[model samples]
Target: MKKIYLLFISCLAAFILNLILMNSAADMPVFFTSYLNDLLCMPIVLSICLFLIKSFSRKKSIRISLFSAFSLAALYSVYFEIYLPKVNTRYTADFTDVLLYFSGSLIFWLTHKFDSPKNIQKTT
Candidate 1:
């Protein structure tokens, strides 16, 4: 659980760095400026969601936590990839972004499950 909190903090730092690289005028590769931030979207949101779940819930449940992570990812994907483009001139829908969100959510879910002590059964 403490490690999960650390992971969330690290993800937050990466997200902030992505924001900086996306907005900075400094000369850099397009990958850093455009795709990097998009790639980080899922992990950022998923981590925050998972962190909140662990923080507030007295009895932590993996199923519930994973559900919340993916649900938030889905909502974010829809809002950013579908709704935002229609409402804002600056935002445009990209399928890659949607894929990234799903991919990130899946990765987070798998890693969390594997790393959790509760998931490991002792062979007596």
Candidate 2:
């Protein structure tokens, strides 16, 4: 729970910074302007989703499976990078974004930890 909160807050901070950079006129590196958001997308989104799931399920020991995380990254890549680019002028296809999405998932997977049953304390 602490780890998830930290991950969520850190990613949220990065996202806010990125949003500021996006809206500001200050010249920034391409990474900050473009790829940073892509790199952050999954962790931020997944953290929120996981938080909601945990809240509703009333479970403190739940964590996302690696396969589920990977599948979501793949789905986002296909939809945003492949499909959206073809249909929307605002979107552009970039294979690097696909890699970044998976990278973000991996980051989320590594950082999103919860106590196991053995470690959880039972209240009397």
Candidate 3:
């Protein structure tokens, strides 16, 4: 579907931009380079997968997507911030990364409003 394609492209663009920022100027804030990517990765990837699978009620899709994103963020936070640090000294626990992950999910939920069924014009 067109919507799925669009979402995919958008996610791809974000990923590319993230990579660019990561390798670009060292002056870039940590939030803009690493934290921002962590925050955005879940929502974008999850949304792409959901949209590709099938269509559901708009509200239901939104709810499920948000839940999935949050779950992933939690898992990621616990792994990277808690578990990984215990095993690897290189991995430092950072609460700010967790916060950024949540922020990213929240942003996805907010921006997703534009993609709601009520907002999309159905082709006849």
Say which candidate scores most in lDDT. Answer: 2
Give lDDT tens digits, candidate 2, residues 1-124: 4676787788889989789878986788899887988898899888887877778876666678778788899999999999998999999999999999999999887776342435443211
- Quote the RMSD, in angstroms, for model 2: 4.5
Q: What lDDT score goes with residue 34 in model 3?
A: 57
| TM-score-superior candidate, 1 or 2 | 2
lDDT of each: 0.68, 0.82, 0.66
Clashing pairs in 3: none
Worst 10 residues of 3 by lDDT: 56-65
**lDDT per residue (tens digit) for residues 1-124 in model 1:** 5555565567678879877766786787877776666666666666665557658867555333566667777898899989999999899898877777777777666656666666542210
| Candidate 1: segments with Cα more than 4 A from true spot | 1-3, 61-67, 119-124
Query: lDDT at 12 for candidate 1?
Result: 70
Per-candidate TM-scores read 0.75, 0.87, 0.65
User: RMSDs, each prediction?
Assistant: 4.6, 4.5, 5.8
Candidate 3 Cα deviation (angstroms), residue 78: 1.2
Tens digits of per-residue lDDT for model 3 on 34-78?
576676666676566556544644433433355666777788889
